[model samples]
Every structure is written in C-alpha cells, then in structure tokens.
Target: MTNHNYASRVQNHNSSIIADLLVQSSDPQNISFAGGYPDASLFPSADLADAFQHAVADNTPAVFQYTDAKGPQELRELVAARHAKHMGYPATADDIIMTQGGQQAIDLLASLFLDAGDGLAIEGPTYLGAISIFENYAPKYYEIPIETDGINLAILEQQLQANRGADRIKLLYLVPDFQNPTGITISVAKRQRLAELAETYDFYIIEDAPYRELRYRGEHLPTLQSFDTHHRVIYVSSFSKILAPSLRIGYICASPTILTAVAGLKSAADIQSPNMTLDALTYYLNHYDIDAHIANMIPYYAKKRQTMIDALHKYMPSEVTFTEPEGGFFLWITAPASLDLNAFMYDVLIPKARIVYIPSQAQYIHGDVANSARLNFSAVAIEKIEPGIRLLAETFTNYLTNHPAE
Candidate 1:
C-alpha cells in the first residue's frame, strides 16, 4: 500500500538518474564522464587552509556564531565588487544574498515564484539538477528548444502571447553562458531580447550562470542581468566551478524587493550558509586574487576541453555530432534519433567498456530526448580523456553497426 503521509507534491517526482550516475562515477573501474566535478588537483588547498586559519583568528567567536541569512556583509561586498568588475555594472551588498550554492539559489527562486500549476518556462535541455528541483513545484512546464545561439525566441514569444494574464509564465530559467550539458552560449542580441521580453511580458528571468566565468575562448559577452532594465533578471552564480564546490558559496543578485523576499526564504529554509565557510571565503578574497586564480585555471581547463573535442573528432562515428564548447565542464553528444543512448549505455557500453556518462533522458523536463548524452571533462584525469573517448566511440560504433536502425 502507498504511504498516505507523504506530500502529494513529491508523488510525481522520481529518482534522478544524475544521483545514480554520480555513485557510478565514484567507482574505480569506470571511466565516468557523468559528474560535473571540478579537477581536484587544482583546488587552492594551501590558500584555503590559510584563509580558514585567518577566519578563525580574526572573527573568533563570531565565525562560530550564527550570522545573517544572506551571509556575511563582508563576503557580500566582495561578491558585489567582483560582480561589478566582471559584469560591467555596479552592484551593492544589498543586491546580493548568499546561499549554500547555485543550486539553493535556483531552489529559492523557484519557491518564491512557483505554485502548483503555475506556468514556468525553461530551456528544453537544461541543467538536470534544476529539472529535479522544479519537479517539487509541479509547475506547468513550457520547454523551448535551444539553437546554436540560444533558445528559440520566436517560439518563446508565441508561448508568451498565448498565455496571458492568469496564464502568463511566472518564471523563465536559463543558463546563458556556456550552458550546462550543451555548453552553448546565448548571443548578445538574444540576451538583450530576453531582458526586453521579460519586461514586456511582465515575467521574471533567472539567469543561472554558474559557468559564466569559465570562458576559455572568444570575447566575453555581457550577462543577461546587465541588460535587464526592469529588474526582471535574478542573476545567480557560484564559486563551485571556479573555486571549490565544498565551499558551498553561491549568491543571487537581484532587485531590492526580490532580494529581500528571497533572503527571508533563505533564512527560514536553512537559517544561513555556514558562517565559517563564508568568513574563510572573505579572507581568501581579501588576501588572494580570485580572478588571477581563475586565469591560471583557464589554460588547464581549455586544454582538457580541447583534448576531449579532438578525441571526439578523431574517433566518434561520422554520424555522431558533439559540441565544441568554448568553456564549461561538459560537452553534449547527439546520435541518431532512433538510438536510445540510455539503453545502449546499460546494455552494452557499461558492461563492455566500463564507461559512464549522463544520458540525455533525464536532462529534459519531458525526458523524451534519448539519443544524446552529456560527457564531462573537468573531473576526469587529463590522460584518460582521449582513451575514454576512443573507447566510447568504439563501443557506440560497434553497437550501431550490429543493431542497425529498424
């Protein structure tokens, strides 16, 4: 018999493939390209150690005590200053609210705006993690297809027009810079248009840009939030990609009203992120140069990204196509529509090659795209990239050849 005490909100939610695959990624035998893990070797261990020591020494009992739900004012100021420098706009500490990570920021926004049956629009193939979070809200999902530049604006506007007043979409979420899974960046024109559309349609935009600072090539584009004139954009980012995931440092920059409300939600949800961690981060920012550290990481990650792309070009079947992302931890692969990559991975690739990747089935809200996969490069050892890709290609080729499309 079903448990009656459970909330109905969780009734439709299923276990995410991402969680299971993350466990698979940890196995010593598997060449896992599943988790969006940063290169462990690059972590600023010594600096962080010193920073932690300084935090303890300087703040003492305060670092150990409860702090503001929006995180330390010092850290927020640092985050605001950094945002101003990188995003080409001035931001104050009041505009920033800290969270456990980008994930929490996303969750907070979803909670603040969405109710059951409320209209929510997201990229067709968005970050899988966000998909899982949105599941709890049970919002009416409108998935817009993505293009080389970004989401199809025409279809989005049509959807917006069709759904007006009570039916208008309440929230639109997107990863505008080197988007998760696909690693596609939205064009500046699209970014401007998105801001304009949000204002015109009277909806909010969540620019989930955790990977914004990781660009390895091309000219850096302005953030979607920068173009936002009506305070429609809630900009979210994290130190996970650039610094360390364990820091659990992420922030939201938005208008005063949104920031205040979200801060309340954040406070009620977890009280606040760990004060010690926030203080340490403050010390690190004060003593060290995060931008320079990020700069140092660029070439390393760039090489890793290029290595994976090169291997794909050299070994992947002619029919298989993959993205060449300028930056970001993962790249996307698209196979023939007839091929179900999830089945292929379990039935053949895993047993035969000991390889694992994030299949596309779980990445979308609809879970209908089955021929694609997301392969991560940042976590895997540099030496393993080519061989793993080659093996992955060989396995896929063998399977496709033996089981030709029916």
Candidate 2:
C-alpha cells in the first residue's frame, strides 16, 4: 500500500483547535463555554417542520432537482430585499449568491479574491474560523487593534499605508455587528472612517454580519455596507443564527460586478447550495414572523448571559476581568498574566472543574494572546451557567493561590 501526502494547504493547516478540544473532553455533563453555537431551545423547530411539510406537500419535481448556481431565484430575491431593507443598500437578486453557510461564503470570497501572500486586514483578536479559512489561501494578515467600540482606526491606517505590495489588499474583512469571540461592535463614526479609508485606498471590504439580529441590548449599528457608496463592501449574512444552522443557507450582497464574478466562482465550487432547504426557508419566512421568533430568543439568551456574568462576579477573582457583551454568543475573559490558560485547561479545569472553554489565543492570527479565553453562554442552560462559571472561578482561584507571586 502506498501512503499519499496531503495537499500543501491541508498539511500547513492546523486542525480546528475548537473541535480538537471538544472531542478530547466529550462529557455531556461538561459545562462547555467553547463553541459559539446557538441555544437549542431557540431553534424554530415547529416553524421549520411546518415549512418542510409545506415544501414536501407542494413539491414539484423541481423541489428536489438542482437549482441555479446562484441559488433559487425566489430565495435570492428575498435575501436581497432583506439585505436592502436592513442595510439601506440598493441590492437586487442579481447581486446575491447563496452559499452553504457563512464559513463557505468566507471561503468562496477568499478563493475569489486572494492570491498567495495578498494582504488581508482583520481585527487583532478575530474569529478563529476566519483565521483558518484565510490561512489556506496563505494571505499576509494585517492585524488591526481592537478597542471597546471597534477596530483601531489609527492602526488600520498605519497598516494600510505600510503595505507596499503591488497586488494591494484584496479586502478588509470585518464583523461590524456583535463580533464573534469578542462581541465588540464597530461604532457609527468608525464605520464612516472605514468607508472613507476604503474609498481612498481603493480596496474592497468584506463585511461579515452573521450576528446582527442577535442583539439583546443597545441600538443596532448601521452595517459598513450601508455607507459604501463606492461599492467597496461585500456584505455576508446567514440564516444559521436566526433560523437553523442545519439549513446551511447564507447570502452575499455586493456590487453587481463583484457578485457576478462570485456567482461564477460559487457555481464552479459547489454548483449550488441545497434547494430543499432554500425552499423551506423561503416558505418559513413567508408564513412565519421572523421578528417575533428573534424577539423571543433575545430574553432567553439575555438571561443566560446575565447568569454567566453574575456567576463570574460572585466567584471569579478581582483581577480576572471579562467583557459584558450586549449581544452575540461569546464573552472574552482576561485572566491574570500568571495564569497559563492551556495549562489551566489541561492540568486543572478539565480534570477538576469539569468545564471547557476556547483558549483566547486561537482567536489571534499570530498566536500570542494566551491569558484569555472565550465563554459561550448561549449553548449552556441557565441552570448550568452559574455552576460552570463557579467551577471555572474555583479552578482559577486555586491556580493563582497555589502558584503565588515569584
């Protein structure tokens, strides 16, 4: 038998750190703050069931047949209309292409735009999945420092100015609303500044807005797409958070010029996304009030977020600080410099605390930030939140006291 080597991209890629940790500590009772999955209770199962039944009953042969490479026309129109209304952009069905999921959309975008060593500007502590996605393309990532409000404008400007490459940056990717891992939303002023910079610098912006509607507090900030008069922003969103993750339906809204190219690329990549799911999702949107469904989830997740915050306050040490996210599934926690989170997970938390969290270093492109971790409150039950956080706190306290100051 001959052994074959993996592709260079595959060989270079690190296996998903999150998946590795989850598999290693597969305890049903484990209080996991690892994955950014939505609460199962919030899934619109009844609506989806109804939609599926309706699609099956109303099924023409076309329902099961292959769809256009750009996806079902009706669903694309609906998505474009929704994007137009939400982002105050002039979008048409022609400017939208459906993909498997938000991640695939990211991959498709990377495939469409990035060549090896192309400059890609991203937030300092960004989404790990995005890091993985871009790594395969081998882009030189420029990390823009993140502040409480958004990405640091000065640093972004500096990086843009510093990149002397002839290919120029393909695009700057941003999760402007309730960003994953950190839950930081870019402010309106920053959005304007970013748009201006994009226009001046003549680079495209890929605005990944997967968590826009998950807001539990504060007013919604306008998306970067909203301010893009120069046709510089390619906005991507999914039904995963709002409807169902299994549906695997996501759409990209861009200028017709760019979107046309993306559609061709998408067709070559996967031909088309699943038609049955698109039909069902369209039926669900038409029959059900999505706003009400989302409204119901807000309080459910808000309560869970509060539970985790309260637990941390009651049990965590004074030096251990965390962000109070207004929306989204994650909270970024920073422990004292002495605490090695990987060691805490391996030697202490996993064994003693019976909890798991995504080490924050996974979020960084350069792999430097280590004294932090991400906590997901959405997946765990309200009852589990307090105990899990308490256990985590106890583990941290023990680690600090046992390994006191040098």
Candidate 2: residue pairs that collide: none
Give the per-residue Cα lDDT of candidate 1 at 267.
Answer: 86
Top candidate (TM-score): 1
Give a tens-digit lDDT track for model 1, residues 1-406.
1457877766556454655787788989999998898999889989999999999999988989988898888889999999999986578999999999999999999999999899999998999889889998989999999999989999999999999866579899999988898999999999999999998988999999988889899989999888988899999999998889999989999987899999899988999999888999999999999999999999999999999999999999987999898888889999999998899888888899999998998888878999999999998999999999999999989878987877
Off by over 4 Å in 2: 1-4
Candidate with maximal lDDT: 1
What's the TM for model 2?
Answer: 0.96
lDDT of 2 by residue, 1-406 (tens): 1225755766545455666877754578677888777888789899899999888778777888987888878888888888777778878898888888898899989988899888888997888889889988988788887899999999888777877576466589899887888888899999988988999988888899888988888888888888888888888899899887889988888877887888888888888887788889889878898878989889998898888889888999887998888888888888888677877787788888778988877788877888888888888878888888888888788888888757
Find the number of clashing residue pairs for candidate 2.
0
Please give the lDDT score at residue 249 for candidate 2.
Answer: 86
- lDDT of candidates 1 onward, in order: 0.91, 0.84
Q: Tell me how many clashing residue pairs each candidate has.
A: 0, 0
